[model samples]
Target: MSATGVQQVVAEMLQPYLDQEGFELVDVEYVKEGGNRYLRVYVDKEGGIDIDECGRISEYLSDRLDDKDPIPDAYILEVSSPGAERPLKKPEDFRRAVGKDVYITTYEPIGGKKEFEGRLLSYDENELTLNSGKKTDVIPTDKVAGARLAIIF
Candidate 1:
């Protein structure tokens, strides 16, 4: 199956289990690294996710995947937490990230720049307020091509 198709199938199959366990499905990746194919599921919760939680989720999904046999070829199935620098793929992610450092990229220039890395001051339905050094930048949410938690030192 295609990479996107694989991710979708895995997400659909595992979402119910994750929800029941108070886990959030952050992202799913099906990629080729060197000669091997890998299927990785990134999960998270309020405080964070631990190794034991990841193991349980992995086992549950493994059983389900084995029963359904969704993938035609061999691949690795991994379940783990989305770490500190997790991608903010949804509005809720941005909301949770308020008062935290972030790195965001836009599809096109906003205020003559496509990149914004700073403290995410706030997030409304339509926009985000970022304190980028000495200046504050207001960026439209729709223009964001990518966003992730960042560490600035």
Candidate 2:
């Protein structure tokens, strides 16, 4: 299967277990580096995820993936926390980051620039308002190439 397909399948497979354990699925990535392929799963919770919990979750997911055999090639599987700079992929992620600092990059320049780093004031379906203290920028959601939690302001 394709990398995207592997990610989707793994997400679906782990959804029930994650929901039951109060763990949030942060993101899944299937990629190749050098000559080795990797399947990485990033997970978190309300109070943050611990190393032991990550091990348990990894073991559980490892078993599930072994059973399913969804991937065509051999690869390493890793499950862990998203760390301090968590990615903002889902709508809920964006909404939760409304009052936090963020680093957002647009596919193209929005206002003669492509990068915006500041406090997120608000987020809606169409756009998000960010205040850099110097100025406030309203960035369209569709233009975002990448978004992540930035250092607290």
Please report, in order, the local distance difference test score of every candidate based on alpha carbons: 0.95, 0.95
lDDT, residue 92, model 2? 99
**What C-alpha RMSD separates each model from the true structure?**
1.3, 0.9
| lDDT tens digits by residue: candidate 2, 1-153 | 888899999999999999999999999999999999999999999989999999999999999989988998999999999999899999999999999999999999989999999999999999999999899999999999999999954
- Candidate 1 positional error at 131, Å: 0.7
**Which residue pairs does candidate 2 place in steric collision?**
none
Q: Candidate 1 at residue 90, lDDT?
A: 85
Report the lDDT tens digits of candidate 1 across residue range 1-153.
899999999999999999999999999999999989999999999999999999999999999999999999899988898898999998899999999999999999998999999999999989999997889999999999999999899
lDDT of 2 at 94: 97
Stretches of candidate 1 above 4 Å error?
Answer: none
